[model samples]
Target: MIHTHEVVNQPPPREGVDEFATDAPLVEAVARWGRAGAVPPLSEVGVHVGSAAFQRDAELANTHPPVLRSHDRWGVRVDEVEYDDAYHRILGAAVGAGAHTSAWADPGAGANVDRAAAFLLFAQVEPGHACPVSMTHAAVPVLELAASGLRDEWMPRLLSRAYEPELGGVGLETRPGAAPRPAQGGGRPRVAKRSALVGMAMTEKQGGSDVRANTTRAEPTGADDARGREFRLTGHKWFCSAPMSDAFLVLAQAQGGLSCFFVPRVLPDGSRNVFRIQRLKDKLGNRSNASSEVEFEGTTAWLVGEEGRGVAAIVQMVTRTRLDCVIGTAAGMRQSVAEAAWHVRHRSAFGSLLVDQPAMAAVVADLALESEAATVTAMRLARAYDDDADDAERAFRRLATAVSKFWICKRGPEHAYEALECLGGNGYTEAFPLARRYREQPLLAIWEGSGNVIALDVLRVLDREPDAFDAFFDVVGEAAGGHAAFDLALAEAQSIVREVSADAAGAPVRARELAERLALLLQASLLVQHSPAAVADAFARSRLEGDGGTLYGALPPGVDTAAILARA
Candidate 1:
């Protein structure tokens, strides 16, 4: 019986290897983006994230989804979300690695690139924990802009790498003489290993992306101090993720209009706020992280930004989160490709190794090409986020982020599905990562904004910010002479842009088309400029030439599948 039950022809667990070191594309992208110094630390992060221990935590965290403990024993209203220790361990590791606020903390050359790379490595293994990490990172710019006094009081704590799991245990106290330092060893230590994670609550059931339609109300408390004007918010939030987060940046209708507010979980007095956790969302995926519907009944809050300018206030955060969506999706693709490649290399079928088979090779190589394109585009966007970036870089980021976010995120689910098929039945089971990945990928597309919302945003930028459009072309134009297919694609994109720009009223109908072309051209341009001829040529032929199939494994004839697979 034991002999008959023996297992064979399976791939070894993908662990212990450094995720950053193995990913040539990511390493090269980091170096090219001016983060050469970050490689060592990033490699360490890679090793930690890719280890078997980390993978176990990821599995456990999701298996035991977060539980919303709305009340304590004796019926005390706690409004708490209880997570498995695995979730805390994963979140702590990510925070301790400075994946959240390293860019803002360091604020110099390659800071954002470094953070983005680290984020990708962590998200690759466990995307559920990345929600709070990303929200925490995005909240920094908004805090700096809307509430200087609150920023002074909270920024240090927010930037701390320590993951404080206890919501009300640590007081909102900043250690004396503590300031943001460079990202060397978690960017300097604080009084203790204490930090805060931030969350956001914007969309209501009535208005998913249309935040303006929110009916939450905020009444003035007639108390103005260093923390800005105070308010008492009373409304229900339909979707508030990371319910365990120490604070949240929320939008509500104030006397003037919709305004931004900072609502802390625990007051300065060390007591919990009036946050009632209605229930946790039974999400399809991302189970480890708690997304909730909460009722804020006369919750003590402080105004952030101006009254009636909530949308304007959180714009920076929204942009940053959108960029993270691209990074997260790219990481998912990388994981999918790596898992598929590993399986194909080890699991022989029929007469030969799957990788050596022409059909299978084409699929793996195509997946690799897609992954590389997404990785390169994500890194390039991160590079443009440097504090000292030139005007052109900034303009490029403004338009390109939306473009990549729309196309790359939308492509994630299909990419995951294709990769999952490479492993046959094993991929469909929870025992494998691809099944989780397939479910996780769709959330990224819906996270920041869905396809339509983002497409319209591209149009908005084109209409309002002409520099952004030109800047996007300027970057793409650099690879103008590299390939005939790319050149033709670029020309086609320009023609479409002209058509969309010519008819403002009709632009929304063609927004998806415009976004898809711009995204492909951008990916093609980056591949041509930075990637190998094999990778670039294959991508341009299959993607830019419009000869590729709707599914993977259909690279044009004569394309070097081996070269692309080598990168994978």
Candidate 2:
């Protein structure tokens, strides 16, 4: 065999490094907010996620994608979605690491922080599987609020670390083409030992964000059992991610008004529910996960919370999912900056190494600043979710979650693009990771709620929950005088808040602006409090003071790019 040319000046593959220990910002944030003992386990997760084998699996999962099998060869209605084996392994690793339910299962000091760190590590490697993972994690709170029987039956299965992709005996009707009886489990149902995942189906074709506009109707089954009020759902869900999940938190119209329901794929009687997959959506990214449009024909469902309180019940799930969106976005940013830094350190141009070059260093350092800010902010939010959180902490999360979701997710695509450009043509190709990241970044912004939806939600918090708004300001106020640039930015953000508070009607027009300023102030505050002096200083001058230009690499002249790049 003759080689066409010996490859030279190309950077080596970036893998096998411990993602957790090497991450200074994540480590510092975790120690400050999360339990000190959590670091050892998180380090183990870092090893697996950063390994070459895991990275290969991630690549294979996306490349093969998932196939929807609506029926078997015998023409029997199967309604199954087949996935690549790599996908299963990836999910298995994540679940085994307690990334899904550690917070709820082992509640203690900084439980959410530990789980969030583990989630960030895994998601940095493969984000497609994170959807099902995120949904399952968010499902705990909603299930807790459910009837005792429902919670008791499902919590054990959900909290299990074992990952079983198959529905197994959890499907409906052994008799071929027989109708499914929604619920008929006598006393305590025989639950499986396998781990279970939850999904969400809220948006319909007619109404996207407006769940009240949903036309799906829930008819009473006239059975008031241990699992709360039983109802039959007959409707079409426009977008249902992870169709193979064990159950879904669905929204439909009840006698009172729009309400939330827990719809399981398999009835308690060991038969499949009437869950039909219309078709899998062809999305721009997140191909490894199956997102489908489903139709429920007399589907068995148990009501969660109360009548006419669907939005209120599901808001808990939405809130957690939105937090994951911020964490996921931060993870992607971390991957981007890390990959860019790794590339520049090895590759050379014009007889000089890329990292040693001023221009390349500035760009990578700028990317690092964004990643650090995001990581710190995400960990702080996770801290708020801890079981020991006081009223002030709870209040802070209510408003801060929306702010971070709107800004960090909005910054994801642009951040990925800049990082992709660092590797020239290599980053643009599917053979590399950045191409996938570019596509993956946008989904976080769209998931849970889009930019406008989140912005308005922030305004709603300000208008309705005065305590939450006050809590947010108090948390950010800790770093008010830490830096001159940050102080000015904080003052300006407060002014904007006052103006928005004064004119509620005009607030809608300034919602985006308000969200941006709040997000920036939050990030800057976290950085000033926790991050190194150089990183915080650069961020304040570049982002808050408007000293930087529109694109990346626009740091101020005196900023310490070396110190920032050191972390990268």
The sequence of per-residue lDDT tens digits that candidate 2 reaches over residues 1-568 is 7787988899999988999999999999999999978888999999999999999999999999999887666566668789999999999999999899989999987999999999999999899999999999999999987898788888887899999887643422446555534323322222343568999999999998998999999999999878899999999999998998999999999999999999988777776688999999999999899999999989999999998999999999999999999999999999999999999999999999999999999999999999999999999999999889999999999999999999999999999999999999999999999999999999999999999999999999988998998899899999988999989998898899999999978999999999999999999999999899999899999998864468899888899999999998
Model 1, stretches more than 4 Å misplaced? 169-193
TM-score of 2: 0.95
Single out the weakest 10-residue window by summed lDDT for candidate 1. 182-191
Clashes of 1: 0
Off by over 4 Å in 2: 1-3, 169-193
Taking every candidate in turn, the Cα RMSD to the unseen true structure, in Å, is: 4.9, 3.9
